[model samples]
Target: MPKFSRRRFRQAKTAPHRGFPPAAARSAAAFAALTLSACAVGPDFVPPPAPASAGYGKIGASTESAAAAGGASQRFAHGRDVPGEWWKLFHSKQISSLVAEAVANHPDIGAAEAALRQARETIEANSATFLPQATLGDSYTRQQVTTAQFGSLASSSSSSSSSTSSSSSSASTFVYGLHNANVSVSFSPDVFGKSWRTLESDTAAAEQKRFQLEATYLALTANVVTAAITDASYASQIKVTRDLIAAYRTQLDLLEKRFELGAVSQADVLSERAQLAQAQATLPPLEKARAQNRNLLMAYLGRFPNADKGEAVDLSGLRLPGELPVSLPSTLVRQRPDILASENQLHQASAEIGVATANMLPQFTLSATGGAQATNFTSLFSPQTMVYTLAAEASAKAFDAGSLFHTREAKVAAFEQAEAQYRSTVISAFQNVADSLQAVKHDAGTLRAQVAAEKAAAESLEIARAQYRAGSTTYSIVLNAEQTLLNARLARVRAQAARFADTAALLQSLGGGWWNRIDETPASQAKPTDIIATSPIAAAIRAQAEDARDGR
Candidate 1:
């Protein structure tokens, strides 16, 4: 309910000293009266309240995730603010470097930055509407006019006088050079807040763009982290598969010797050979996936598919964060960029309603022009040649086939639509956070079970090999044990990778610490390492980026 100042019209110094006519003076007084009485008309915008739910999960439920290898139990620290560089929590050098590279060189980030700049400029342009406009002009023309065109009486009198004087007279054209100069001033006061509403709409639009830029930053960093984790996961899987193939080939060798010695049937060797081929088949797909993941990482770094990336990563090097930050439901609405952007759109829609309503009322415009005119350029500014005029206009549409009324109705509908969209965005944001929280929790339990299964399979495989060597167990038993062990190992690797990826997802869902950033310009210009060097949380990773650059 803030009151805005009215834009007052003032006469320019170049205006003629004679001032305005009586009618113009009366109109000016009326305009001033309207300006003082007018107010911005429409429903003022108010932000939607946060959802009534207190917790992301069932009431009184624990927010801690189960413990597993490569990560400890992760607890959601409610009301804790996220760090500016949330990726540093992983403590991985390769991930930090990749994210920094993407932020600096990605085309999408640049485009978003440019869009924000454009929106800011538009707001600035719209602000100028509150100022009066003045223009100065000068012109010279040479023209001729016939005496008869002035009046029939003047023509007839001149002709009669010529006849009486015994001289013939003709309607002659008079030609002269006329010069004129003038300065004009005009202003349309926002008596009903129409111009102010327009400015408000533009300002809100700029705010929306600013939030979108932050969203872009958050998305880009999260994607880079996810891609790096994928690259590491695929590499680990491929290596484990190749090792399994080697074990199978060795087992086949022993089976073949036993068959030659008449201790085993030929069928056993054939069966072992088939298993070895199957295990070998698994390698090609893993290799293909690993290659594809590498290319994707390069793309995320804004490089070509075959570009030289100096270092590689696997699950072995990346550490899962033990602590996670979670904002309160009320804070989530403020922290999330998409939600904030939606709220700004709602604000703009509310302002539009005011603009539409103002259009249906009377509009006031005041203008003045003063200048000099003379037949000779030297006499243009003389007192006798001076001329001036002033005017004011008030206009209101008497009838327009209900167009203005319908337009206001449309604006009201748009405001309602924006409000609905804002609510939807808030609901979706909360859903994202809830989903990530559950994934992190279950991923840990899966990893713990997979680890135990892998250990038991290894023990079983060792016993089966010993029993077969002593001629106490069939080759089929050893084959089954070997296959189980291989499956367990692959599952363990995938589980470890999942833990890392889900941790990153949790950070993204919580808005990626955009609030910690002071301004948008820094992310676009400064390197991630440089920006986070002063933070204790990022000190270790900052060293890693520096070391990588130094070929350490």
Candidate 2:
């Protein structure tokens, strides 16, 4: 309980001028005393406990590299804290720079930052309610008054001219200016801590927005890094296609010369030419994919496709991060932005229950006005014309078909809903981490298989070419071998790229290390590229709460 008593309402005799009976006055005073002597009404929020589960449960809490996935091994360091700059672990300056550029320029980040700023400002505005509100006002008026109503019945019979003069003298109209000025102050005494609860709710709402901003940053930075990886993959695949095309052309040239020497049939030469054309055909689509991927990259950088500066990366440039972090399940619920945001919502809803309960309780207001009134502006503050008023009001509503009670019940339901949602968010976050972990483990297997197949196909292609050159096999066999190598080569590039993508996804699922960011309030300001400030730990729990009625 906190008290700042200006005065207490005293019960007195119900005189003719008294507004309420003595008994009612006493009841109000007692209510005020009891409420003022206690803390806020309704239950305070307690953060939900983290789950007791020790591991990511059958989802490969820890993993060792498969023997077949050799060279593609990623060591998952369980219970390790993810670094704030996780992308830097890839050791790609290209990726790091691109992420920085996108963060600085993205309109979505600016919008999210603005939302967070607005929420903070709202809390600032609500803080004004904690103190007395004072207003100063002045006004003037001009009007006319006459004394005709106070005149006696006229003496009619003796002299007409003298009677008319007497009447005119008794009733005269006068015009005058009127002026008034006053300063009035009013304050609500939060006997039940309605003010405190309201502030608590608002603060929670602000926190929710901050978390939303963090989520935005997490999504943005992760997507940028992933897109860059994909772009590199596309470029790598394109180069592989061109190399395959070149190989086919060389084989086709060899077959055409053999046909000219009558060492091979014309049909064999035609088959080799067809294979070369088919390999060439694969080039256009790969080029298209790479071009489109570059366009997507341009968009992420907040630029038009035509504005691209040919900022492209090579697959060889990105070093696969050797060490990867895997947070404990308990830590993830707190670190994940969505979960934290949901928790804030629960906090806000808990506060709302207090607000609603307070609304149904007695409310008290104190006000005072003191100033002066005169016939002119210069005389408005004169002592002789001074006047003042002091007032204390107490009110409580009763039995309006139970609207306030039902409203309070609604807030209870909302709190329950928020609690459930918080749990749901936690489940989804863990699922994400599990899914990424699986990708990290299995993508390697796919890559290893593709790499092996590509090697085998290349060997067979060489053997077929040698056999044809030695007149040991048909030219058609060489064409078939070339086709197999092309497919295997493309598959290997894809599988290799999948490894990078999976690593990025896993890092993202672990919450992108936003809690370790350098800037706590960077979203509102345009910081430098290297500031690492666009993200913060989700400190907000957004409340889509229904507004509770406050008894004023």
Candidate 3:
């Protein structure tokens, strides 16, 4: 009520202190001590040990090579590294170019890269908690106040010098502008390392996304190769079917002429025509399969279905790798993207336990608000208008019906789950390698058998056709011979393609040689240009448009 009381409060605020001001001195010393003593509450992560097994499986050696480019006998080069561009080992320029195109264009790769970037950005945001949060602010206002609001205090000061008592007591208003500017700061000291633990968890999560991006790259490239192989196989089948149709048509024509001359019966001509029809019937499905493969390639290259269906990769163009690379099982744990991803997940889960543990401890915060205010703009920063406040708060979880306890237990359980999943991933990786190793061995034997069978069937067909022409055998024998040869030829083509595909599978199972890559950029730092772009087909489509514009 007295001006003396307001003066006393301001005088106490500005009074000199002997040293650092007892309260502030104590808080600063305590903050330094806590900073020196604090440690992260959660356990630090250690990577899981490599697997115990030395090798995937026995690499069965074959003595005989099959009769074609993809039918060569393969040997295992154990402990040798895989190449980064493994597809190029096939020595086909088309395959290499197409795989490069798919890797550059695939949507899955872009999505993975974006996810990795987001995870990294979240880490950066969380890191801000370790530093003080400061804000600069300024404000202006127009204000009006009534003298009656101050009551007796306003009347005593102004009554004697100003006017009559009734006028002082009656409501009178004053209007003025108020100006304010301030810098405010708040900081929570990491007394027990909650922020550090959270950061560790986030860092591990970002690595998880990194490996996920690697997995996407690995899958996209491998799929492109496998799809190319399948396309080539389908193309071969279509060609074989077309040839069979032509031969059957010619045989039918020969038999019809013989029938007209009475050299062959009407039944013979009808049977030949039926065989020709059957051969023609097999053509559509093969063509459909080849077309579907083209559509799949279009998808891999990030093109529409109507986009330039690229030329089908020829099965005979692919040269089967003779010496297959087989990495040790111990190394596979580190090499495979899926296995590494699971390991990161396990690491993140471990960090989470520390975060949950830290949550149970006390948290401390210090905040200061300093500012100046004045009724007029010119005096806004004057000494008499300055003001400030200091505050300290400490909080701990006291009782929450055992909720924090269960939350920690849940985190521990999650860590164990991740550990189990990591082990499962390792097991699956080893199994894939073993299966691929065996496939490469056995596919050769299958190829050799089909080649022999095809040769014998061709010889039998020629004998049957000749004997029937000499009238010593019937058309049914020749028909059986032709069918057998057709089956043999188709089977041989498949067997040939399998060797190339299985070799690829083995390489993929060994982690696709990503570690040997020259560009070591992780997914988190990748630019948008690194993730997505138009496929080679885009250029082709543009060319087609230009051709149409020119009336070509």
Candidate 4:
């Protein structure tokens, strides 16, 4: 057992009754001793290993291409002039507004914001473990006592009668109230840094939540952009199909006239009518799909998932950019919020291990409580009635049913899991960027080829019309050429929209903008986009979001 000294508690007893100087001096001395003697028992925290190089499946993004693009020196690269408002690159005001609206009012985003607030509160709660706790209380009681006739009878018959005549022994009742007032302060110094490690872990968890929120936001924005593009593309396809149907109807009229005149077979006129019906049928479904996509966009914006009456979602107002920005390396990985969040989680897990190890060591706590007491309420404030108790405690687990050992093992496993997840996140992020980059590139090429095919089909249709007028071809030839051209035009529109969607996806995966958008550090730097890493921008957003949740 550790020895105790009176001087440690009642320092003023040895000297004159002064003010709080002696108490303060004793407190300082005790703190110094605790600081000097304190040592944490658990394993020290060390960040889990992250892959030196993220292993990404190649999709055309290579070191040579990145270097040639002037982003070679960067660890995570990206193209420049990738405007912060990337949605604007598609040149659609409606799309931009929808994306903005979704970010502001999305239900999932709101839930994530609430979770982040809870995480902050959790950190604050955990911080109390390092400080002392005290509670104040009071109570009152009443009691009554009665004399029994049996006791008097046992004494003597005359005595019992006399006692009864004197006084019913008088039923006695008493009431008393007790009021207790005291202030207690306790401190279990982190000699071994257990508290510090715990704080670290919590900080990391908070960051993870932050990044998750950011990732969700980015994905939602991308969806809005993609949906808008698809809607417009469908509309364009409908127009092309309607035009083709009109052309086929004209051809059908001419073919029927020729068949009546014994110039063409009934089969030829029938083929033209069938082709016209097919083209006309195509318009309704395309329109329906466009409407459906618009509803989906509204849903993402936290609006009711139903079509609005005359709700005009203008896809035609959007413009596509001529070229996609291409930067590589230091910019791409650094700005990725999810990857940074993963890093924070790994750090948090490392801290948890430290906290678990600290459990194995001796724990020390210092406490002091003082209050005045008296039977009479009037004397409660008198210094003469004051009483105090100050003590220190130290304890160590001598035996347990393998609980501590298992806890340490669990934390270790958690640390490893965090590490693996971190690496996987990094790898996946890289793959997404690479795939999107290649998609946009190849889709553009496909669009050019389709354009050429459309031109050829249109020429063929014109030639077939001239040949029919010259009496060398039937209406079926003209209908076939028009149909081929219509298909090519529709295909081109889809490829164009797909290219835009791919570009938006790449931007979202690369964390929304150029390298300047993200902070590259072992300790994550927060951003407006940061859901997990403590970027200053994200912090403000989180504050605003939490304030909204609290109805502030």
Local distance difference test, per candidate? 0.72, 0.71, 0.74, 0.62
Off by over 4 Å in 1: 1-38, 59-69, 148-151, 155-168, 308-310, 518-520, 523-552
Candidates 2 and 3 compared: the better one by TM-score is: 3
Per-residue lDDT over 71-103 for candidate 2, one digit per residue giving the tens place of the 0 to 100 score: 347778888988887888888888888988888
lDDT digits (tens) for residues 1-552 of candidate 3:
001121211111111111222332344332332343256566555577676644676766542487765877777887789988888889989888888788778788888889987876776677567568899889999988887776666556664645556655558889999899888999888766677567667767876787888888888888888888998998898888899888888888888888899988898889888888888888899889888888888888787889855666888777777677778676777788898789779878877877787788888999998999998878976899998989999998779999977787788778878888887888888889888888888888888999999999999999999998888998899999999998998999898888888888889989888877753334533221122112111112123223432454
For residues 24-49, could you state the per-residue lDDT of candidate 4 as single tens digits? 32443323323432443333333333
How many clashes in each candidate?
Answer: 0, 5, 0, 24
- The global Cα lDDT (0 to 1) of model 1 is 0.72
- Candidate 3's clash total is 0
Candidates arranged by TM-score, highest first:
3, 1, 2, 4
Top candidate on lDDT is 3
Model 1 per-residue lDDT tens digits across residues 411-525 = 8778778878887898899999988888887887788888889999999999998998788998789889988999999999898899889989988998888767544455333
lDDT of 3 at 116: 81
TM-scores of the candidates in the order shown: 0.83, 0.82, 0.83, 0.75
In the predicted model 2, the residue pairs found to clash are 207-540, 208-540, 208-541, 208-542, 344-541
RMSD of 3: 15.1
Given candidate 1, what's the lDDT at residue 518? 48
- Cα error, candidate 3, residue 54 (Å): 6.2
Candidate 1: 10-residue stretch with minimal lDDT = 8-17
- TM-score of model 1 vs. true structure: 0.83
